[model samples]
Target: MARFSYRGRNAQGQEVSGDMEAGSADLVASQLGSQQIIPLSITETETLGARSFKFDQLFAPRKVELDELIIFSRQMYSLTKAGVPIIRAMRGLQGSARSPLLADILGKVGDELESGMSLAGALQQHPKVFGAMFINMIHVGENTGRLDKAFLQLSDYLNMERETRKRIKQATRYPMLVMIAMAVALGVVNFLVIPSFSAVFAKLGADLPWPTLVLIATSNFFVNYWWAILVVLTMGAVTVWQYVQTDEGALKWDRIRLRLPLIGPIFERIALGRFARTFAMMVSAGVPMIQVLGIVSRTVGNRHIGAGIEQMRNGVERGESLLRTAANTQMFSPLVLQMLAVGEETGAIDDLFEEVADFYDQEVDYDLRRLADAIEPILIVALGVMVLILALGVFLPVWELGSVVRS
Candidate 1:
């Protein structure tokens, strides 16, 4: 008999731990199950011929690279769909993994499986890479014997998320570049060009035009107190950062962000996309509806939307239909509520949510592109107007000075 140490939750939901002798880990688990204890971990106690240690195992945290996880999910789904045994598919993945961390995890999972652990149980050991949502979905798939389908769905979801984020970043790139360029241009004019102009006007010993005088005063202030400006900026940024760390401040700020013009709609669409897609995935994966709502609410980045979802969850828990709760929230669009109602009536809520997600994802892409297009012309016009004003301010005085000299 092997000596096994186990940690489990008992019938009363209290944690229990102890050592027991059993024929195998499965036997130990079975014994625990009979005692109404849900075993979380069970490790065998082994006496080695010599003390041995694997430093990698000791320090290894279950971290799989994002790209590696995506590729592994796709490959595993393909292999499993082609009728490869789970263990064999895992072994192939383990052998082919370029990431040492992922490879080690796969190897450990295989070893645990060989010791009679279920796939979901083995995966749960690597919580860093596979979160509770991912693990729960896999467990559901295992129970339903649709592991390949589950992996395919997860891969597709992740791919969509990655692509959406990429598009968002791409859409914002030009505007960000323009803003940085503007800052650099203004900084150069303020620090270097303004000082030279100021010296020239001062030496000319003439009364300056109103615009030039104002500009000179501004430039002198910046030049003489640049250190004070830097200190103020640093302190302001630190204050904002500290305020954002507080829950109340963060919630208030997020609410304000969701109400801002031009940007608010884009933020709403992004949050809606995330909520719809995650809820759809969870529902399709056979997670309970309440649990799906709970996860979706937490995952939505906007606190306002998250709070609305929480209210919807409460309504649903009180025996209201999902569509009814969603409609009552008033945060979701009428189209979304109507489609959800239809889905609820027809028992295709998951499909409806997926459609909603797809629609919003496309909308977000379109909005981002439009926002970029709008921002480019607006920023150009604003910059051009500023430059025109600056030109007049500098040249008007110089022309006046020339007139005075000729007179």
Candidate 2:
């Protein structure tokens, strides 16, 4: 047996470290899980007489991407609903996993289960893969003994989210393509076509028109200083990226993005949809209403919306109705607030939230379509205006030269 050193967080969120004799790191992790410790890292310890040597090898954090997680959740739901054992289901998934990370996570989960750790406790160890909301839902499911149904609901929710993102991407594709094409055309004209024409006009022994002169100068600048322009743009992008990484900057930017014209409504809908869906899922899974609001607040994506939800959470904690809090916030529309109020009155808040989410999902789709239609004409007109200016800049000089020649 080899001695291994491990670090982990216990159930109380306290960090703990120790050495154990185990067959492998996986075995060590499984043993720790059985003790209600979520193992973060494990390393082999070697001793050479009086000298001690330690080499640390950290396990990669388990992170299943949205697509993989969705697929796994759906499959698990199906198998479990059909009365398959959790262990057997996980083993089959681990064997079929194309993602090494997912496979490793599933293998570890199975090992932990074999070592007598509850599924929820085992999942809690991998917070990077399964977030607090997800783990809480699973814990509730375990408590209620409806893990399969919960998994199915989570799968459906994730699939809806995936479809929403796909539609948004699709809607933005035309604008992106047009912008890229415009940039490429402009670059070619400035760097190649204009420069060649300028050289020929210069050899004609006639004073070049002012518009042509300006175009030539611009082309020359592009040809000679393109690298400098590229460097500046790259630096600007990197600076913005770094700035947005800060908490305050990210919150500020998210706030600004939510207030943007034409896009703001879409963003608002998307955030609300996420909030409603997540809140519904949490509530349906038996999470406390206050905790549900807190989780939903964090998941809203926009700081303004999250702030509003936070206020609503505080209100709910103070015994105020969720509908009243939502209505007072004024972030949600009247229809949504009314629906929530009715849901509360009927003691079906989860179902109401689900309906709200569905409504906003449809609204988001409509907004995307409207935004796409509006932006296409605007971009086309902008591109046309740019081309017109270029044409005038080049041709105005030629017209002046023609007048001079005729005189």
Candidate 3:
């Protein structure tokens, strides 16, 4: 018998993990099923050493995007729904994959399945492309004999996520464009326009107005130290990028983002929407409460919320209801709590969570509509002020000089 490592929730909902001697990983999972335990993952010990290798760091292939996943899921669901075998579906997908990297990954997945590795096990080897959430859901689908439905649910989830992201991008696009325009305008004035005005003022030999003096000094700085400015900005951006890649730094940064004004609530709604929707999907898919919570707590994309969900999972493991545990966390709104309470009572938690997700969707939609109104005015006013400054700083002296020349 081969040794396998497994983690799962026991019949009493307690978290349990240990090494078990079984003929295969599938057999280990079957053993757990016999004990009424929900297996999260079961990996044979022989491959465990190689699984931990940092493939992501070493390979650095083209990263997978949400749109790509959405397309993949949709196609996979259609094929599966049409009764295509998993291997044939994957091979067909490999042939049609838009990205060469994705095609290669699909080919690898098919090869692994050919060699008798479970879908989850094969996908686990490509962590950069597929996350734990994707793997766990596939495992659940495989176990429950609902692989088609699983692909359909994943497709829906990914599509919703993609739409939400598009909305956010739409909401911010105007502001981003405004800032870029302002930057370009400022650069033109600093290097080109201001220098011309400064030369004319110097030729006039007049004592400059304070604004003009300030503008000339700024132009001089841009002219003399532009390289230094560029270097500093580049270095600062790289530093922040690297720092945000670390665990603690990312957690802190995520927390900071949630507290930011005007945008924080948007992200919070996004996180809640994701949680409610994924939770509903998993519940509806017949995944157990413990397994659903375990998978979702890590996939919500917000560290603070994920941590709270994890705490709730542990609470449930200790014989606490999800609602009571959620109440203690104080992360959810009262309306959501009420809905969840009703769901808990009615044994329709999935339906209630779907409603909750819809509510957040409406909230996000409203906020996105309001975001343009909120940010555009501020950006416009800032742009106006900058223009007013440049007019006063550069034109006043030119006006005086022109008046003198005309006279």
**Overall lDDT per candidate, in order of appearance:** 0.82, 0.83, 0.86
Shift in Å, residue 37, candidate 3: 19
lDDT of 1 by residue, 59-98 (tens): 7655676678789889988987899988888898999999
Greater-TM-score candidate between 1 and 3: 3
**Cα lDDT over the full model 2:** 0.83
Q: Quick one: ranking by lDDT, best first?
A: 3, 2, 1
| Model 3 whole-model lDDT (C-alpha atoms) | 0.86
Model 3 Cα lDDT, one tens digit per residue, 137-233? 7877888988888888888888888899899999999899889988998999999999998887888887678999999999999999999999999
What's the TM-score of every candidate structure? 0.78, 0.82, 0.82
lDDT of predicted model 1: 0.82
Flag regions of model 3 displaced more than 4 Å.
Answer: 1-61, 399-407
Candidate 2 residue lDDT tens string, 1-407: 57677787878887767565567789888878777789888998943243443443145434677999999998988898899998899999999997889998888888766655667766866667887667767777888989998898878877887898899899999999999999999898998889877776676556776667788889999999999999999999999899988988788888888889888889989999999999988887788888888887876777778889999999989999888898888889999988988998899989999999999999999999898898988998989987886897777766766776798
How large is the C-alpha RMSD of every model relative to the true structure?
7.4, 6.5, 7.3
